[model samples]
Target chain A: MTRTEATRTGLDLAPDARVGIIAGGGSLPVEIARALARQGKSPFVVMTAGEVDRISDFDDYEQVTLRLEDVGSLLPTLKKHHVTHLVTAGHITRRPRLSAMRLNLGLLAWVPSLLVGVTQGDDTVLKLFVRRIERSGIKVVGAHEIVPELVAAEGVLTKAAPRKSDWRDIDAAHAAAKAIGALDIGQAAVAVGGRAIALEGVEGTDGLLERTRQLRGHGRLAGRTRGVLVKCAKPGQELRADLPSIGPQTVEAAHAAGLAGIAVEAGRSLILEGPTVVARANALGLFVVGLPAAEPAHGK
Target chain B: MTRTEATRTGLDLAPDARVGIIAGGGSLPVEIARALARQGKSPFVVMTAGEVDRISDFDDYEQVTLRLEDVGSLLPTLKKHHVTHLVTAGHITRRPRLSAMRLNLGLLAWVPSLLVGVTQGDDTVLKLFVRRIERSGIKVVGAHEIVPELVAAEGVLTKAAPRKSDWRDIDAAHAAAKAIGALDIGQAAVAVGGRAIALEGVEGTDGLLERTRQLRGHGRLAGRTRGVLVKCAKPGQELRADLPSIGPQTVEAAHAAGLAGIAVEAGRSLILEGPTVVARANALGLFVVGLPAAEPAHGK
Candidate 1:
């Protein structure tokens, strides 16, 4: 659907329809909740334990904080609130601690699948996790369905565009990031000069930026701020959840790391607080752009 | 050549052939010099500036200290000593300051190629570098020619062989290291659990090991000392110079980083101070093995 159609005001839902949100840590979840409420749909918000930051004025909302292992309780809570749609947003660092989990009638059925996800990478785990949620009768939807503007649009979103010399590094970052993502190793990579200097491991994007800073301090990087950070959706990623995300804080991190700009895959990544991200990047003289989506490749 | 045929060595040259050694750094240069002298051929040693540690006991030896930029003078020095074969050993970090350079006739003539090399990656630059030397009519040979035992033999070299669980990490590292080397980005990579976590950049192998340790410390690694470090030649490398070299120091570094083993490509990489390296790894309970060469791929 066109973005305008996706963002049209009013509910296309049944009169009694209520949305259910499995909020992971990040501002995106809060934004999604507020957007849904602005349209007069009082969504049920279930905050993931230890993952989310503080949510303000949440007393009236039908929500509870639960650890990842306590995920089975989410269905009954949604069912209690009569939720028909489910959306999960933000990030979960890794597999939850099984010891702290409280498995219930809902989770006991998916024990085998959860075990399989533990052995696989985060992408596979989230894929299976979301699939299990879908099997519970409530339809799964992407946060972009609620906030279409969060999906990055094509082209530069900042006043500070990449310089001519930065294009090679930009393209290099794009290709390298995709190659690593194909292995499910990472979704972001930093390219300096003409080659990729760092790949994100399980430490995630912020860790990658910090590592790049360390490499630069060691004279490993060329003596300039000509590098770019490229983030994209992993090939065969569970699109309904775990999409690559960046916020204003990511802009500050990129600027601090001496990167020239940030490039995220258009239409496949979340740009949380989009205007502020662009404005902050522009103030710091860094570009924020959205490139075309990544193509699939067979895993080696 | 078969492994045995390659190791069966004696000087395969005319009786008048005098070897010239382009020694860079490390004990390998001094060791190579001593071996050649024992065989009755005192090779002319050109010590690259600021690279070699200490070449003690060299009062009677014929050697000259030359800055990397003074590379132009090497040909004339070889002519003066009647040197017939030239071999560059040890490590030359990068080009020297142009201002400190005293360019000789040959180096001045190859300024264009050197500039082109400067613009490209190490593999391209090294290829053109050896070509320039060969064009000057001096036959270039591998350091392994003088020290055939340096070439790593197949299979485990230490008392500790990789366990079945370690093989997956080894293979993962081998494939990941080669993939990065294919891009001329690095020669080594570290794999933990089943995925590659750190790839060598210009920071080299020690830096790669340190980065892996940091990732592990940050809980990015699987919960165990099961990672392996893999080193190999870049596909289509100019093998006469810059073969990947690991030494006793590498064993200590691997042990310190809490890895299970180290793997180098058989028939291609150099095992500096081989016996000592094996002994140290055995004492540290770490395995050191030479993996077979990487196979080619036609897949895109």
Candidate 2:
């Protein structure tokens, strides 16, 4: 359906429906806003400062831009917009310097808990945030509710399947990555010749790939044979927020790093711009395997 | 026992019996040679180049110095010296620089396998080497066999016990260390406030500790809470060779890094100059736990 037709269907608002979008950094929020409009809901958007910009495209949306610590203002803003159903979307890039945050009264009370939870992993932080919001009488929905097609699925997504040996490396990488993730460190690990070469840390995936490439250049990487990059969710990871996601950029990075294959937790991950990602991976002869969260095969 | 009495005992070996001491870098080899002299066993030392200097003490004894890849020459030297049982000791300070090694005929056949195994973990590379030695009819014995008292036993070695919370960080560090070890990357990990801060790589323990201290200076580490350092053997490690070892120097490094606790795998790990190391750690209020390989527990 056309964008105009979807918006027209949502022109008449339902009496009790209340939707609030906690927009972070990305295009996901815009997509969610469009979806809400199609369902006769003009969602209220709470855009985080330094995280989100541009809200003029939303047909009937009211936007409030504030810092992460401005929960007191956020609650009142949601109340003012008659929002009862709250949803959070997009990336929240970590700002290690916390002194700059302008925490309000509500967030001030949460500072200690938030600090502890933040070190526990992204899922823990998101869950804690959700709990705080719920305690404020708001029900939270999954980000995928507005864009269900974005969720990844199980099986080989690329044209070429990983070789048996490459599968072993993938399985090893997955286990290592999960262990690393459990420590709230990073989300990706590169396994070459059944050994972990580099782990993703605060530097993010691009940096991790670059490090892998450098190691390869130095002949330190045993990637004379095929290697695998595995991304998986930590045990007890929250699915609604911060599920490990990969995009076209990730494919380009993997190809440049000479990775033979990539494996990600299926259903629990997002394949942003899936078609472009798969096309790039295929062009570079890289295999992309989507693994189910349950009964994840020891790909080897 | 007195040197003369020890020499009189059956522990003293006949001059004809070949004993290969695969000497690495350190004063341990010199000390070991003196101990062997007291027992009347003049070992045939094979010292790695850039690892040990002055095989002068072995002038009266059979000795040969070579690179790590001189397996071909090693077999002939051992055979010529009538070397039957072999003991490897001391520290090999240099990491394997794949590009620099000049492999001989015998090593060339094993180089590929060794490379693949090294990436898998230290044990694999050590085991592959051990297998080659065995095939050439040499018996590989534990380095601690020369000084049985150096093998650490399971329990708290220091007067100080880790605080309850610090123990959690120790446990996490131990697990992290083992995971890195399994990857054949490194043998040490430092964790503070339940987060891993540093991992050992191609660098030795001292370098690892120094790097960690620098990172801690970045103000991101647990404030005022000293971290725990854990060292252990890789998973499925070969017990007879390349066991994780600690010494008085390790304790000094730990103190310099402001570490609160140290954990090493019991029985499988060697404690060079154990009394001095423990005395220093205890004086510094650092808990030194000699943990059993089977019953994995946090330092607490």
- State the C-alpha lDDT per candidate: 0.75, 0.69
Task: Give TM-score values for chain A, per-prediction.
Answer: 0.91, 0.83
Scoring the B chain of model 1 against the true B chain gives a TM-score of 0.91
> What class would a CAPRI assessor give candidate 2's docking?
incorrect
lDDT (Cα, tens digit) per residue for candidate 1, span A1-300: 113334542336777787888887778888788788877887888888767775664555788887777777777777887889888887765455566567678778768776775445667766776777778788777776777767788788888888876777888778777767777778898888767777776678998888777777653343445689999988777777777889999999988888999998888888898778877887999998888775421111
- TM values, all candidates: 0.87, 0.73
Question: Model 2 misses residue B166 by how many Å?
Answer: 1.5
Candidate 2 chain A, poorest ten consecutive residues by summed lDDT: A1-10
lDDT of 1 by residue, B1-300 (tens): 113334433448677988888887676787678767777787888888777775664444799888777778878888888888888888775555556667667678668665675435667877776787788788888877777777788888888899986887888778777767777777888877666777676677887777776777553343445688999988877777778889888888888788999998887888887778887898999998887766321100
Q: Which candidate comes out best when scored by lDDT? A: 1
- Please report the candidate that would top DockQ against the real structure: 1
